[model samples]
Target: MDLSETNQTAYRHPWELSRMEILLKELEKLNIRGEVLDIGCGDGYFDKEIIKKFPLITNIWGVDIHAERCVHQGKEHYVNSYNELQKDKKSLILF
Candidate 1:
């Protein structure tokens, strides 16, 4: 039931993931869209839902430690150890 394990593509804790998926589908019905950034996106399971449910999203980015604890194939979103996330006009969605 641990879908968040190893990128098998399921929610980490099971029910928590299921509920979020249902909610995201409902939001899609309202015509909402934008870039999505999944920080600490552990296994990027939620990111998968965002990509499938939200077609309006033009880009998807996720960041996590390069280890088994957080290994997900993302678009290479890495900030230098000294780098800071500067907030500009762009949107930022964190979970």
Candidate 2:
């Protein structure tokens, strides 16, 4: 699916929207609570999505190869590599 160059929120592939909801629901059902490090987090979009759905997550951090594409909605931090975030052992890694 191709997203519009102007606004990503205005356009999304079906899988992009559905998968995020499914993942969030599964995470909630599992009742996982801890700092979360999202790997390959493009623009931190899903980071915002998960945090919005699961308030139990104490800390949210995002890592991606393309640092220029990273985005944050709240206190979330975006890094370029897993090694940067892996220095802290407290986070629950997600891909």
Candidate lDDT values, in order: 0.57, 0.67
1-95, model 1: which lDDT tens digit per residue? Answer: 44334346432565766777786876667665666666666666667777787777766556555434344355354444314434433344655
Q: Each model's TM-score, in the order given?
A: 0.56, 0.73
Question: Which ranges of candidate 1 are over 4 A from the true structure?
Answer: 1-13, 65-71, 75-88
Pairs that collide in candidate 1 are none
lDDT by residue (3-85, candidate 2, tens digit) is 22325556656777888778877887777677887767776677777777777788777766666666434335544455656
RMSD of 2: 3.1
lDDT score, candidate 2, position 45:
73
Worst 10 residues of 2 by lDDT: 1-10
Measured by TM-score, the strongest candidate is 2
Query: Can you tell me which runs of candidate 2 are displaced by over 4 Å?
Result: 1-6, 71-86
Highest lDDT, which number? 2
Q: Given candidate 2, what's the lDDT at residue 86?
A: 47
